[model samples]
Target: MKIAMWSGPRNLSTAMMYAFGNRADFAAWDEPFYAAYLKRTGIDHPMRDEIIAQHDADSVSVSAQIAGPVPDGKEHWYMKHMGIHMEDTPLDWAEDCVNVHLIRHPARVIASYAAKRENPSFWDIGFQQQLEIFERFPGPVIDSADIRRDPEGMLRKLCIAIGLEFDPAMLSWQAGPRDFDGVWAAHWYGSVHKSTGFAGAEGALPELQDEAAKLVAQAMPFYAKLAESKLA
Candidate 1:
């Protein structure tokens, strides 16, 4: 199975990938389009410069290499992507694959985005764009927060959406990174690499500034409505 999960940053997206990669039979890839997008656009991402400074590789090139070929093993392949990354890529690349759209509350997302020194997110921009894409997609969609809350139930539902039966293996994963997750781990995720299972913790992120709070509130209605409609 070729499964693609699209999500925003700081939304436990990396953790989710870790869960899926635990399946011994599955191969996964993390955020392949990032490097190619940066290479083609000459636009720098928030962490692009810093990450490149250390890794000395473009994220797009690395994503492509990781995504390039699936090994002979694994019945299922999962791809974890940031929804905002879809802005410039070909939609058909995901054709014939299950598109799992993941979302998080704008308030929390904004808070997370702000905590990172680089790349103040274009939250409104990214959110609105993803909302439109979700509306257009004909496949199954889901909320990341909901998945964390009910791993087994949600995995079953996700399997059903893609015409597969639930496998007990989806519920939990062994600690550490898998081959499919290498590109992402090497780049964007350090904390996730050390995790043994779902982080499972949910709460307010760092306190938001009044200005950031208001910005998130303004975008909340749109995200809430979108999630309500898709998840309903």
Candidate 2:
């Protein structure tokens, strides 16, 4: 099975990827369309040039690569994708995959993202794009907060919802980068690379001020649209 796990940046996405990648039966891909997205939009992200040079810069090739094989001969594939990365790519490749949506509270997303990249725009967080994909694929959605609060419990529920068996290996993983990490890992994956498992439950919603607050207001509706169907 090809599991297309869609999420936004700073939303515990890398940790979830690690959880699934830890499973012996699954092979994982990290942000397959990142390079293509960068190349297409010419966005000045950190390591932009390096990422395009190191990875497939063509969305067509990347799409075929993902849809063609279960890498390493694994029984399942877990692909961690950011919705914003789908900007210029077609959804045709995802047709056969078990498309699942991953979400986080907009306030939490904004707070974490702003720390890494200052003044992140609404589009940068990918909430609206995530909702667009949810509408097209119409599959299960899982919240990062729910997963952090009870990793195994929520993951087990996630597995059941997606017609897969729960694997204990999804609970933790070795710290540090994996072979499949995107070249931009050095820029975006610092916190996740150091994590061995999902962090503990988050505290009260952060009180956002100024622009950050407005950004959250823009994202909350999209986030709430998907959160309604997230695995409880």
Candidate 3:
């Protein structure tokens, strides 16, 4: 089985990737289309040049690769994807995979993203884009908060939804990096590298500036729509 677990940044996506990576039957991929997104938008993200040079920048090639066979003949393939990465890419290719949407509250997402990018907008947080993909290709939606609150329960539900057996190995992993991590891991994966499993819930919601708050407000409806369908 091939699973496309789509999520926005700062949404426990890396932790989820770690969970799946710990499974012996699964081959995990981290943001396979990130380089293509950077190439298409010319966004000056950290390690931009190296990222673009390191990964395939053609959307068609990337999509084909994502739908291709599992690496090393693993039984399951778990792909960690950013919804915004599909901004200009085609979606039909992904229909073959079991898609899972991971969501987080907009206010928390905005605050967390701002710390990294300083000026995150709706697109940066990916709520609208996530909604679009969810609509185009309906799938299971899991909230980051829900996962953090009950890691095992949520993961079990996710596994059942995707027709995979739940493995206790998904609960913890060695604290470090893996060979499959993207080159950009140095910049974005510090917290995840230090984590062995899903961390506890964060503190109170962060206070956002007026502009950032407005962006969150704009994203809340979409988040709400998806949240309504999230696993209990």
Find the candidate with the highest TM-score and give its number: 2
Compared with the true structure, all predictions reach lDDT values of 0.65, 0.91, 0.89
Which numbered prediction scores highest in lDDT against the true structure?
A: 2
| Model 1 ranges with Cα > 4 A deviation | 46-70, 123-125, 182-187, 204-207, 230-232
Candidate 2 has a TM-score of: 0.98
Predict model 1's lDDT versus the native: 0.65
lDDT of candidate 1 over 1-232, digit per residue (tens): 7777776677777777776776777777777666555555667565565434444245445545444566557677788766665665656556656777777787677776666534354552357666666666646666667777777777778778778767677666666667665343554566666766665647655566677767776767667766875553
Which of candidates 1 and 2 is the stronger one according to lDDT? 2
Q: Over the stretch 184-206, how does candidate 2's per-residue lDDT look in tens digits?
A: 88988888888889999999999
Pitting candidate 1 against candidate 3, the one with the higher TM-score is: 3
Each prediction's RMSD over C-alphas, in Å, is 3.8, 0.8, 1.1
lDDT of 3 by residue, 133-215 (tens): 89887889999998998999999999999888999999999999987899988988898899888999777878777898899
Q: TM-score ranking from best to worst?
A: 2, 3, 1
- Those runs of model 3 whose alpha carbons end farther than 4 Å from true positions after fitting are none
lDDT of 1 at 199: 56
Off by more than 4 A, model 2: none
